[model samples]
Target chain A: MRSLDVTKTAFSNTLRSKMRTFLTVIAIVIGGFTLTVTSGLSAGINQTVDDMLAGYGEEDQLFVMQASAMGMGEDLGPGPQPYDPEAGQQSSTFGQEMLSETDIEFIEGIDGVTNVEPIFFVSPDYLETSGGEQYTLNSLDIPADGPAMELVVGELPERDAMEITIPDTWLTMLDADAEDYEDIDPQIALGETVEIGISNLAFEQETVQAEIVGVSTANLAGIGGAPMPSYALNDELYEIQNSGLDVEQPDAFIQAVVDVDDLEANEQAIKDALQEEGLVGMTLEDLLGIIQGIIDAVAWVLYGFALIALLAASFGIVNTLLMSVQERTREIGLMKALGMSSGKVFGLFSMEAVIIGLLGSVIGLAAGLAVGFTANTLLTGGDGPLGGVGGLTLFALDPVALGLIAAVILVIAFAAGTLPAARAAKKDPIEALRYE
Target chain B: MIIRKTESIIELFMKEGVMSTPVLETENLVKVYGRGPAAFHALKGLTFEIHRGESVAIVGKSGSGKSTLMHLLALLDEPTSGVVALDGKPVTKLKPKAVSGLRNATFGFVFQQFFLNPNQTVLENVTLPLKIAGISKSERNEHGMKALEQLEMADKAKNKATDLSGGQKQRVCIARALINNPEVIFADEPTGNLDSATSETVEDILFGLHRDHGITLVVVTHDEDLAAKCQRRLIMQDGHIVEEQTGASTTTPTAARVPAAPGERPQEQPSRRRRLMKFGKGGAR
Candidate 1:
């Protein structure tokens, strides 16, 4: 018989026992749906991580710090450690080991290290607007090559200009009177001047006036939406804070940013080199690897359940085809007597299985896409749980992965069909014709 | 026009004194059901020759081996030890594929159960043989319609087989058997499940095809009235033919047996020694 005719007949035969076929298809549907949803979930989360990574600086940059600064080797065993005099005399701030000028020069000399700059820690007490209304402030001195911020209406501050960039959330506090934060335009705060107050070592307050060069949107990497100051303004503030006492302040910092070539290939080597110098270098991947690992583990666990479901569904396919073959014994015998070959009979049964697989997977994929896209829309809309996280999609479908999943299910169905098909093919025409 | 053309050719051969060869010949045909002492001998050394355009019936009671003999003759089963020849060629050496191909091209069958797929339409059921032969859909449909028209079943083409009456269903089977234009038609108790009136109608249709189209007809039945309608009869008992008779309707009754051909052995009783040798070969595997 023609292959097309066999396929057509097989499809029609599947419709003979509608309830049986439906139940088998439902089993496959459960497996397919679970597989599609989990794959989409993995895609969505990985895309979100990529978006967050873009907000950080270049991938080849690392934040280096003193290894002992975070109390890594500190003794906490209910006894005071015998500290050396040299260790006690080392400059420290806020219980952290400060990096001296010698440390910066040493890092610059490290092989493969292209550039190294000390990160100055700045703490401003408050920001007083022209209306004399003072609000508490948190500030960061972003370097020229530091992380790029997503802006609302203006650009980053000029490196040499005495200017600062505030977060978009501060627009209402800076310009509004009726406490309507959503109605305030962030562009209105551009070019505005504010006085930043800091405390000197002698407890004297020193204020510096700086222009607002930009407004930045809130983001996951920014933590609490800290304002950023230009390099010139941060230097001036730091110099004023240290001019209080007769003793000359030491040039020390808690951390430094390092730039390197071929960071992906040399990251571990550079980190080992820094470890010998009593320092630690952390890449962005190093900081976020734990999160990525957790997401991957969860996706795999879900996929495991989906695989188990598919295995059970394949058994359903075997059972259904076997029963159909048993019921059609006389029909098969008649066809054989009419000169239909055994191979054609086998092809007919296998085609039935493939049709069932196609039905289940197409329906399951459509349903999964419907549910996934709907959930993504609801979760990412305004006032939703993920609304605060910009550019976040909770479910993302990859067409290639979906196609592979469907093809795999069809193969499993065909494999499950072979046993029954062979049984039908081997049936003796005389015996089958005589079967009651 | 095709029927007249076939008739003219047959007449021409007869006028020229050309002897027509037998369509089917079987010699020393033996069929056993099982192995060892429990073996049931179904057909024991039955020898017969059926010529073209002949209507023959093998009539016997149930378990008399008439069905088994018909199955072997139809190439549906292998003989325990014997030879079944079709068109003067020994078929035992043919591969399974060639055997099936020969059956598909040369023989059509109508069963007592009227083995039509009840869910399919009459047209689909009738065109099954052509479909199995891999004929294109449009061509098969055209041939199917012509066959159904010959059986006076053209109007019922669109109806389901289950919706047809017993006689209508039998006519549909006859239409299916005629669809491939086979040389031989094997009918197993064609009237066994029909009423008397329907049986007569089916009988008329079978006989009409034999007379008009010059197709060989082989019928297996226990009904004496049905057997007498055929031109020849072989009455079987205990797995072998015990009597041969010619019907009253035939003008000439040909000899039931032909002499053994050159290099062929005469028919003999099925011997235990030959069966034992066959069994030993099977046991060694």
Candidate 2:
């Protein structure tokens, strides 16, 4: 029937008034932007949490060093000859095996362990640069050929010696002479001694010369939560360093960090093994709890702004539709005179509101992107708290969030349009026809 | 106008067609504005009938209920009491939607102010009744063009009705009334806003509708001359029909006095219907 066709025509025709239609669309778009961005940020934060709890990648082999088994620096022997490669690969000149009695066979029995090096290590003192910057050094326990061990320069240190591998942080904080370390070939190496300082404030007058060998990159222990303890190293004064701790042999070698098949997959088992071996490591629980705190903070902050924008846009729609009712009084009366029922007139105005809403959402996406991009770039500079956060989060483009924004804007427009549309539909034709 | 002369002969063999059918019937209709004792009674016990193909003029002074009676008959307002039947169907009790449908389809209305949907064009105004009734666009154009052709305003079809002169606008209003092929035409002060010349043109179009197409027409007017020119005239006073004039003869009686017998004026032939009322029959009316 033509009535149905006329309804669609009416919807299009109502939007034809250019100025009024433009304003209506603007109101809706603003509403859409508020709704889109708020929901998107919430969804984005949630997805990040899920990705983090998972362990390592799909392909890799691993082994766990329980209780001091992975400790590499504890065994000192042969009177500082590890700096010389002529020392045997398994010289066994050191008195004690770093592993306990039973760990060797038990670890070997599990399948797919192509090789296992029972690693050993000791805690060392904080290494201090001439400028007074301090950092602790960590040891590498994997094979010299293993993927975990990388040589920045020189060669891997041998067994039964004072020669050691220091992480990147230890090399970075140096005196002026070591600062311009561009060429490693003609640069420094082990047996070429440099002064290292002790930073114990109570007895802070200690300084000794140590030979530098291989350089490692696992220096920032705070980041991955690797273990560290204080110890001083000096090639010329090695006898004096052990004389202060003063024992022919010390007994505590009780921790190990096992590199697993997948770090995240075996995190629970690693945690269980550490419990069995009386050791501890950082776990996913700590990461998740911290992320949850950040998520709550972001949601409340964005939600506050969105609610304000939505309220303003809602008011605009109501005001615009009300003015329309007043402007078209005679036209409404004429429609009634031509035999249009109140319900049909109501439907026409409501459809007009929907058109306005859709237009606004489209425009809002553009406007929001403009503001979001500029704001994101400004926040992206690495000069403030939480600076260098990822790119302006694409809030509006998220599907669920965009859908929700559209739904909310349309509903707001529909609701705000009701009173004015009803008023137009219900005007008495006789009185309206008589109006000027 | 001469086409009605031909129908005078055709109705002779048809007794049912002789008296024709009353397209509009009213029985003691009343309208009271406001509520309780303060209500102003606009119409009181007004009764009338208009036959098919009849042109009627209702003339009265201000406040004599001509407009009120017209509005009630137009189905725009509810009558406080009594019945109104149009073409054998009771109309006084139908719902609002049904009333609008019946009026849009069956009755054409013109007003003194030339309420021609000022927002629309002359052609659009004429086509509105068809549109309201959900007629096809092509058919609406066809019927609207035909109505405009009848009024000799076809060339001015695209002009806005509000832009036309009172006379030209009324011509478009006449075309609008006929576009739906209404069974009855009701006009309230149709020429009241026009000059004498324009008023005559409107009256001419209405008379042509009745005579050529056999369509019924009822107009409420204060102009004595306009009222006097119709086939039937009614004078109302304070909601009462004080005077009425039956149709002036459209034909001359060929026979004198007696012998041809009782009720012989209407011819009875084999091909026509019996003396049956096409509209109201069973009630006391």
Candidate 3:
């Protein structure tokens, strides 16, 4: 028979047994819905990583940190780690091991290294605004060639200038019950000077005043976190806080930044150079890879569950088509008697199966997309549950993903319909016509 | 159009007695069900021939193998042994595709049950065979409507088959049979489900196609009156032809075969015909 007639007949037959067809379709819907939601979640997490990682680090720069000899090859059967009272103190004074002038000069002398920047991390006692409001501050020196942090208001601090950039979360920290603010001018105006203090080991506080240069939308100071300081301000505070400690030259440095000639080609060479000094190399992509690997592993587990649902739905298709074949024995006989080839008979039944699959996938995909969109919106909207974290969505679906889902469903339905269709095709016309 | 031209040339050839081939013929046909101790023979070494434009009826009680013979001749079943030919071509061992091609092109069938698909409209039922023959949609509709019109079922083309009465359903079946314009039409107890009045109507339509369109008719039935109406009748008993008769008015011949008359060639005669009708003048030749 003609393909058009075969398809039309199969479609009409599908409608003839409405409840059975609907029930079969429901199985597929459940499977496809689960699959779609999980895929969307995977896409959403990947998109979030893309957004965050875009602003993470510079292409040609790597962070070099002192490798701890004590932690290497130490697999002390793990419970709560051995409480070392000096561990916290060591981390607190980590920046006091700042690279000396000679070390910096030595790093700058490396073959492929263009520049070397030493990071100075400092903890300030309190930030005092002109209005006399005092708040605790947590600060670090921003890297010179790192990804430019996205800003909500004002501009990045000028190089070698004592200016600080604060995150949006600092506003909430300042006032416990702050209203949702669109711009940050209410809490702290840009270009306004704020006094910061750091107490030296002598128990006397050293206070330094710096201008607020920019406000960032970074999640640096998330809920209950501390604010970030500009590179120059951090360096200035480091100088003022350690002056009375009698710490002239640091023994070891926490971290240093290296600029290389060819990032991809010279990365290993630079890493080797850093390793010679007992330091480790960490690039932006390596950090991103660690985060992505964790996310993808979780997503695959969720996808496996969706596949189980789809497998169950395929059985539903097989059962429905088998029943249809049994009921249409005489009709099939009549078609064969009318000179329909076995191949055409098979095509007719297969078309019916595919139509059922198409219906299920379409409905399932639409419903899945709707649910994904709503969940994404609720989680990522301004003032939504996940609103505090910048550039994060909970669910996402892409065109290619949708197409693959449909194709997978079609294949499953086709395979499930095969046995029943073969039965119908191989049926003897005489025996079928003789069937009561 | 090629089939029509071929039929016309065959008609002219028949007038000159050159290409007078039977539409279908079976030789030493055999069918057995199961094996060994359970074997039951359906057709035991029977041979028969059905000629073009000839209306022949095979009358018998149940299990006399009339239906078996019909199936073998229709190419719907494979004989355990023997050759079945259509238009002088051996078709018993032909490939499936070629057999289906011949079934679609050279024959149509009307069963006792009417056999119309209840899910389809009357028009769709009529066009089914044409669709299987790979005719285009537009031409299928045109030929289907023409065939339905011939059976006077054109007005009810859009109605579903279940909504039709028994006689109307049989007429629709006849229309479906005629849609492909086959050389032979098989009616297996076509009037068995109809009342006497409806049966007459169906009989008239079946005979009308045989008479007017020159389509060969093979009616398998147990109705003696219906069998007598055909120009020739074959009586079957114990899976073998017991008797043959020509016309209802003719006297019954004995079991002995008739001797060939002088100046008559046995090879030229397909099946028994009372008188040859003239061709190209709306008369059977």
The prediction achieving the highest TM-score against the true structure is 3
Q: Write the per-residue lDDT of candidate 3 for residues A8-109, one digit (tens) a residue.
A: 778999999899999999998987888788788878877776776676555788766554422322446758766644333434343232344455677788
Residue-by-residue lDDT tens digits, candidate 3, B1-285: 546534643553354322267777778777887899998877666666777788988766677778888888899989998788877767876666556666777788998888888877999889989888777888989998898888888999999999999999999999988887778899988888888899898998899888888888999887655776787777654566655666643346323242232343234333333321111111110
TM-scores vs. true structure, each candidate: 0.81, 0.63, 0.85
Candidate maximizing DockQ: 1
Tens-digit lDDT track of model 2 for A88-117: 221222422233424444444434333434
Chain A TM-scores for all candidates read 0.79, 0.52, 0.83
DockQ for each numbered candidate: 0.53, 0.26, 0.50
lDDT of 1 by residue, A384-423 (tens): 6765455567899889889998998899889988989999
In order, the Cα lDDT scores of the candidates are 0.80, 0.58, 0.74
Task: List ranges where model 3 is wrong by over 4 Å.
Answer: A53-57, A66-110, A138-148, A172-178, A182-188, A219-226, A240-244, A247-254, A272-279, A393-397, B1-19, B248-285
- Clash count list over all predictions: 0, 14, 0
> What's the lDDT for candidate 2?
0.58
From the highest lDDT down, the ranking of the candidates is 1, 3, 2
Runs in model 2 lying further than 4 Å from the true structure: A1-9, A12-21, A39-312, A369-396, B1-19, B136-146, B149-161, B247-285
